[model samples]
Target: MHYFSQSFNYDHSWARVVIGMWHKYPNPHCSHVVTVDVVDRTVDPRTGIIRTERILGCKQRAPIWIVKLFGGSEDAFVREISFVDPSTQTTTISSVNLSLSQFATCNEMIRYSPAPGGRTAFHQTAEIETRMNMWRSAADKLENWLALRFEQNAQLGKVGFTDVLRQLWEDAKDKPAHVSA
Candidate 1:
């Protein structure tokens, strides 16, 4: 299985600020931003694990309530990005794990669910919460570090959609004439 792990330490209340901001604007860049909206954002205050299906203030686009809470793993994914706000500090962690065989179909990752063999939601909720916490802590540290570097650089900004399209177009531009598209 392939996995991506990262942790970051935010200065002062940076973690809270970032987490709050992310919860508001999950997709900072409009580039890959589809109609992806936060139809809901409820969380368990005690554990910081999400509780409701959708956060009340989340502004999801019409339809598609079947949002994905997590994605990417070999054993039926549930990658959650969690931010823990302690009294003195906050931590943000994000991780991605996946199988070797699911490489090409990775984008269709939502299909990878823990509800295998007809498992009920009650059984899976606790498991998902546990997994969310694991990844959340890791993401907190990784994001904190990233935020610090970005702060030091002070030049990082959201990457736009055109950048992705341009890269793809450029790569295709060099295609052989025999392999015309």
Candidate 2:
């Protein structure tokens, strides 16, 4: 199992950040994300918290050997769940790949919190677990490769999100002051 975490600040309010998150895909930095669909969405009447479940289709640029080893496939599906609390100004999201979980599982969690100066603090945590056959040397190599790929993907994901955040900031400036989240 491998674990990693990172933190950063975005020059936008928590409300704007949370709104931007909903449209983060299809960015230039994350071209591998082919499609996104919202499976479910609901808002709690009592708590005013919003919950959403989404699925993302990803095309991985994996080595041919890796693709052949995994049934000549480069497509992966990811399931994501998010919770947004309006009153607390906090949002949490978790995502995991739904395919090929028997050999490995990678899970990522992100949190958006209100920060000083109208900034939004973003924190992300990623975990990868590999289940390999003890007698197979290829399994060990695959695990290492997966870990490295995950690290790279995380960085790209951050860049993609930042691009979306900047767009959101610009859009907010265009909106009327009477508008409310």
Candidate 3:
């Protein structure tokens, strides 16, 4: 098993950053995410919290050895669940890869919260583990590869989301205010 964690701050408010999360896909930097579908969603009227479940489709090339060993193509799928609480100004998202569950599992967690100076703090962690009863050498190699890929994708995600937030808020900031007749 391999573990990874990272934390940073975004130059945006918590609310704005959480709202930008939904628009992160289809970004150039994170092009591996091909499709996103909302499977379930609910809002708590009393607490003003929203929970959402989604499936994300991803396509990325795998190493030749991995392809031969795993017998899978470039397509993969992930199940993601998220919770947003306005009262606490926090958002949390968790995801797991579904395509390669029999061989291994990659679980990821991300959180966005209010930070000092009106910024949003971002934190992420992941665990990559190969199923038991596999050859130890092969399992270690697989875990290492997955960890490297996850780190790369995490960096890309940060860059992509930064672009999305800037575009979203900057464009809105530039627009003129509407006047009621």
CA RMSD (A), model 2: 2.6
Clashing pairs in 3: none
Q: What lDDT does each candidate get?
A: 0.28, 0.82, 0.90
Tens digits of per-residue lDDT for model 2, 1-181: 7788999998887887777887788878988899999999999999999999999998987887777776537788889999999888889999988876767778999999988998999999988876766336667666677778888888998889888878656756766422344
Error of 2 at 100 (Å): 1.6
The runs of at least 3 residues in candidate 3 whose Cα sits more than 4 Å from the true structure, single-residue gaps closed, are 173-181
TM-score for each prediction?
0.27, 0.89, 0.93
Of the pair 2 and 3, which is ahead by lDDT?
3
Query: Residue by residue across 44-126, what tens digits does model 1's lDDT show?
Result: 66766442222212122221211222232212221334434444233333323222112211111110111333221110011
What tens digits encode model 3's per-residue C-alpha lDDT throughout 1-181?
8999999999988877887888888999999999999999999888988999999999999999999888899999999999999888889999999987898999999999999998999999999999998988988998899999999999999999999889778756544422122
lDDT of 3 at 10: 96
Cα lDDT for residue 7, candidate 1: 24
lDDT for 64 in candidate 1 is 24
